[model samples]
Target chain A: MSTLAFLGEFGEAIQFIFEGETTREGTQVGGSQFLELTVEHIKVSVVAMVVACALAIPLGLWLGHIRRGSFLAISLSNVGRAVPSLALIAFFVAYLGVGFTNVTLALVLLAIPPILTNAYVGVTQVHRETVDAARGMGMTEARIALRVELPLALPLIFGGIKTSAVNVIATATIAPLAGVTTLGDAIINVSGYGDVGRLAAAISVAALAVMTELTLGAAQRAVTPRGIRLESGRPSRRRTLSTRIGRTASP
Target chain B: MVASAVAALTAPLAQVQLRDRSGGDAGCVADDGLCPGWIADNFDRYVDPLVQHVYLVLASVAIGFAISFALALVAHRHRWMIAPIVQVTGILYTLPSIAVFFLLLPLTGRGSLTAIVALVAYSLLIIFRNITTGLDNVPEEARDAGRGMGLTDRQLLWRVELPLALPEIMAGLRIATTTTVGLATLAFFAGAGGLGGQIFADINFKSNVVVAGGLAVLLAAVLDAAILLAQRAITPWTRARAA
Candidate 1:
């Protein structure tokens, strides 16, 4: 339970990597360690998150900027929300077999909706007058969207990204079933070994998560455009009330 | 045609039920007859576990909502404090389920208590942020008018701001409910029970019917419906708006 003991397990793995004693499958001087499991999991999560960000960002921008197909994008994102990511991951495993590729695909699918929805909402929510002013100043539509609208929406978009990153990082623990190694490997493998290792790895992942949260949050705030507030400091009761009414009318 | 189609569809189902075990290979005992009974027994095994699963999610979400709502109210009054708290909660919200569960295991052990604590921590950020945002969105003029009319702080919150914020708060609850249901699946990994157990069983046994897959889908539907109903009941305003 001491920090030293906690670091002992994690640090040993690091030392193994540094000492070149660790094999791809995780056998070491002691033979047949769980390092490979750890590597596979880390790889699965990283690859999946990278892929998701790649696809989702562009789609989100389009949906956020274009405003026409925004509903389609938002709805797809909503459906993503509705269907549990774990179920989707399981389904992929069922259909595609347990492996890195399928697991990554599932995580990518899971990560997209938040990113896409947030980006789209962020851009769309950029004030109409701001867009008009930009246009009046003779900025091109693309230029306006990129320079003006994007900056305005950056905070919200980053907020979305922050949210997605947390989700992906946490859900990555489940990637083990798809034959991808992850932090969950320890939790699952060491369940019989007194759960100490499991607890240790869990703490490590949580630490990693807290670190990830702080880092991304700083990054989000950094990228988030400042000095833009809605003319109304708070969304008026009448406005929200009206929007609620409108939403109800359609549904 | 219908009979033949049904048989054809069931052929795959039968095959899945008969597959070899992947992880829990030791337990994949095959029975050529009584497939229905096999499925029934599989479900029966889960009765106790499934109850635990439902209990874990409901309890954690309820606790999380209460804590988050209280915090949100405090933040609402002290507007300057909202950002930091929201940011901090947002970070907590992002912690991986396994990570959070594992992190808490030292103190909580591998029990429902650990899972609930972790889940409640995760839920707090979302629920708190949403409630604060909802309450904040209540008109300042309305609040000022309430105060001008000699309404106390509590009176303003309950009679004015809370009602106005109900819709958004309910939306937050819906989001929290769905997220809790999904995350609760991880509880099985920790031995807390529920649809995850069924799904895990199916996964290990390679039986599609009993594999955590089918049962999870069913449980998800039920959870979704239950939350939707709860949302409707708590925010009768939502119904009023709809009507």
Candidate 2:
């Protein structure tokens, strides 16, 4: 198809997104619903991310502080990667009934493993010398973890959050399946949105996901303290070798 | 308890399957329960979709690896290129494949091509980062040894660095494979006939969803195990090392 034909009624599609349209089938779509769905999508993702962070971060930090359950944190991450988002959502919809809570619960499951694993890994990787010095300074365990280890581990912890944030937002596209019509309403109910409107919705979702990733990435950088920022020059071989050894030690 | 839960899950599906016109055993098929007989009899129906799914995963990963490997090699030689390449691929990675399907539809049109392109984009960041990190982590002593033997830069990279990097590279491939399998389930949106298409065709039917989704999950596990085994075979040194 020529560019012209391919973009057939593209202007109308944009209009349909901002100002609702009655399709040939006479179904109302786009317009204000787009804003509603977008808000809902963000709300669900934010809720899931908060819960995931609350549940995973402390556990990860405590476990990492104790330097135990390395196997649990790491393996949970690996198993989490193998589970497909669609199946998880479908299972929840099938068994638990569908709505904001069920979908948010499923997303929290999706979001947890990475944050948990990263938090654990990050704290464990904090320098032994640093931890010892803090202890030597008569710092309590909780104080040391919060003031020293937490700040040092913030970058990696944020790295995990960024990963989960993107995953959760992308997964939110299918929230419509659970009777929560996010932007996926346009994509799923194609007859209602029509082909052009579907394309518009897809573009919007893509934009949303990319924007989330970029924003979180910036936030991650901002939260990282200057002392821990990686220097421009590559580290010497000895430093890298130590990290390599650390990798082998972990599951 | 497990059986009861499965039964509960399947109950909703019975109504969905009731709408389906064709069935060999109307009673079992009608309820859309976990009808093993229906799946067993209709096993042939899954064959084509499974093949297509495999093709989608393999092709996307292969092409992704080829691109990433080449870029990693070039980026290794010019370290400055790494960050920009990563940023671009990272954006690509973050974009969900479902949205990608529709985004590419107007340009690439609907087919395996559209699905593969999105899948390939998603794989690039994972494989590229792994390869670059792997090369970076090759021990200084290994390079010195190669140089002492009068090996050129190319030979040292090929014989010393790349060999040492194999474990990490293969690990990236395994992750990429599993991820691609999960993502490819949505390829049906791009008109690529993967098991995802099968699942989405009658998503409410428990037996249908279970069989199709199970095959996908099974595929990921099998591929992951195969890669792990391959890693062991190729890097016997890793096996010899104490855990």
Candidate 3:
């Protein structure tokens, strides 16, 4: 019955895609169908991203201010960046098994590094003069960082978050492989057939993903305070070597 | 320093020792006979595809850079093409790899060609934007000087703008290569080529010794090292500036 319907729908598949098509599995493919799937993907990804930001931003700021854990913090973030998300996904699947929770965990793991790295880099790279000036004015350490370093670091840190968000959103397409409903399903569903309809649907969803990525990116850009430029001076000599190591050791 | 030294020396080693002694529970790398040998043998299977993967990345980057350069040059001259071009590529970027794979699968089938085409598309935007940025960074005075000296536009671009743009171009290339290498893992899903094949094969079996996790790590390390070396080679300005 489903095959018959599929064949019936097949004639007008391209035209019918936006409207739903009923298949053998009793599943319907349409705009609402895609919308629901996309929403799910977005929700899972966003939640993970938010969690990552929550943990990463404060920790990143703190780590960035202190000189001691700079190496470790940087290195940890690098591992997050350096390791392939798929590899981590696979490792997560191995340990946690396949599910939304597992996939989300993998994504969160992937997401945290960039946010942490960027935030840390941004704060640490804050102009020493600016920091000194704040300190000279008798601002507390916390106040100095929150008022001075964080605002200056905002653009770069946000850039990292934006990059990570795009990455995770794109990666979330893989969620379907583990039996989660996502935009990834659009790709996997069309694997057996040579039909371009599924491919088109997949492409459409990916476009949506990219659109969301860009929208968030634009938001970050719009909010970026213009004063920050790449700090011209090299990091302290000790920091320079560690930064190199940190970059290589992780992402 | 002392506290960190103690933590560093003890923590990781203790964790490994604990996991090893515990035997079966560690998520990665199991204690089995001939794990290293199994990894070595599988790593051998990877050599050909790895070369192809490298070739694919280098070719895509070279081709993409050239294509983007031409586009950037035209767009720069025309001015109006910039927004539209960025918009189109931005759209292209959001399209997932799987979507690209399946979309091209009809025209190209499950071949390395499909991967190459997708990779080239992916590289396009990065290189294009970077090229334009680098070109834009060339000072107006420099362009005026070239004009006053009676240099042709082509000569000016080739001799002056390109040299100034070299570091930025190399940075874009570095990003392109790394992105391509990572994306190449998706090629394995198509069953055509790359180290992803070995990784997937082991993944399917859930066997650690056979899977060669260490080889994958090594492969990543080597690829990263290659990029670092390439970055230094291509951007002598960075090194000279550092000195």
Candidate 4:
């Protein structure tokens, strides 16, 4: 098919989401279906992210402050890569029975690694002397973490959030399989939505995923301190030789 | 459950029949518990999907590597191409594979080809970043010495830069390969017939899911290990240095 034909179909699909479409069985699949499912998708994704942040950020920041668990923090994402999301969901369904809570919990586990890893890296990347100076000024450990380290690590932590958000959103596309009617029903439930509805729903979820990524990206930029933003262009001598030697386009 | 167990235990070993995944023991299947005997009997069902899964991973990673290698080299030489290329591939990488699988279905049709295309798009950013980082990390002195010896840019890249970049390049390949393995489980959505199809076929079946899903994880581990081993063998210098 031509690109024009595809676009026309895509446009029609989008309109169908707003106006609703009826299946051959004469069921009224209304426009609200799209909004309803997308909202659920966001709801679950948001809940998962909030829980992941609550669990991972503090643990990661504490580990980094104490200078422990380096191996675990760094290797988590790598190990995460080997495990398939589908399997994780299926495993949950098989063992625990399927529901919103089960799927959400699985997603929470899936989303944790990137956030935890990034939080650890972000905090540990802070200068030791900076933390020392905070200590020397009579700040408590908790105060130093909140006042000195958290601000510096804000951009990277937000980066992890963006990543986890995108991942959780993507994984949520399959949440329908476990009995939650998210936007994925458009893709998975052909009988209910038909071909055009599937395409339309896919487009909507893709847009949502991209929008989340961009919004978080902007948040990351906003959180970055001006001094760090300016200094990011300059090579750091403090890093190990392996990291410092790279002569590439600036970050 | 007890009756089903008695039936399973009383059945003569030689008389075992190939029951459907859900056909094995009534209580066992009802409970969705792992029926090992049924799995061994039905193991053949997974072979084809597992092979399809392997093909999806290999073809996508190979194609992704070729494209990324060319782009990385171009970006290395021009310097200006890096940002745009990274941005574009990063978007491709960020888009969920399930979405990409369907998004391409209209344009590319529903088949392994569509699945491979989506999978390849994902590997581009990962492999490209690593390849470029590897290229860039080659010591300045090595390049200067090659230049002083009257070596041209092409010769220097092939003989020194690429070889030196092997470690990072291999790391990228390992990551891309493993990630593709995980993602290919979803290629069943594109009608690519992978282990994912098998798992999804009877998702609630404990035995079916365990075997099928376990195989996918095993495939990722095997490919990752193969790449790590290949990297070590090719870059004998790295091993020697460590020793």
Q: What is the lDDT of residue B141 in candidate 2?
A: 88
Which is the winner by DockQ between candidate 1 and candidate 4? Answer: 4
lDDT of each: 0.64, 0.82, 0.65, 0.83
Evaluate chain B of model 2: give its TM-score: 0.90
Comparing 1 with 4 on TM-score, the higher-scoring candidate is 4
- Can you give the TM-score per candidate against the true fold? 0.77, 0.89, 0.73, 0.91
Poorest lDDT segment (10 consecutive residues) of candidate 4 chain A? A242-251
Q: Which stretches of model 1 miss by more than 4 angstroms?
A: A1-40, A136-140, A191-194, A226-251, B1-47, B78-84, B204-211, B214-225, B233-243
| Cα RMSD, each candidate | 9.9, 7.2, 12.3, 8.2
Per-residue lDDT, model 4, residue B14, is 17
Candidate 1 shows a clash count of 7
| lDDT (10s digit) by residue, model 3, range B1-243 | 334323432322121111121233333345333344444434455567667666766777778888888898898788778778877876666566656765564446556787888888887877777766677667789899989999998899888888877766665666566667667766654434665554444443344312433334455557657767876786677688889
TM-score of model 1 (CA atoms): 0.77
Clashing pairs in model 1?
A: A40-A181, A41-A181, A41-A182, A170-B96, B198-B212, B199-B212, B202-B211
Candidate 3 CAPRI-style tier: incorrect
Worst window of 10 by summed lDDT in candidate 1 chain A? A242-251
Q: Can you tell me which runs of candidate 3 are displaced by over 4 Å?
A: A1-18, A25-36, A66-82, A124-133, A189-197, A225-251, B1-34, B40-44, B75-84, B106-109, B136-153, B189-191, B201-224, B227-241
Ranking by TM-score: 4, 2, 1, 3
Model 3: colliding residue pairs: A78-A250, A78-A251, A79-A250, A81-A251, A82-A251
Give, for candidate 3 chain B, the lowest lDDT window spanning 10 residues: B12-21
**What residue pairs clash in candidate 2, if any at all?**
A20-A31, B14-B31
Ranking by DockQ: 4, 2, 1, 3
lDDT winner among the candidates? 4
Chain A only: give the TM-score of model 3.
Answer: 0.79
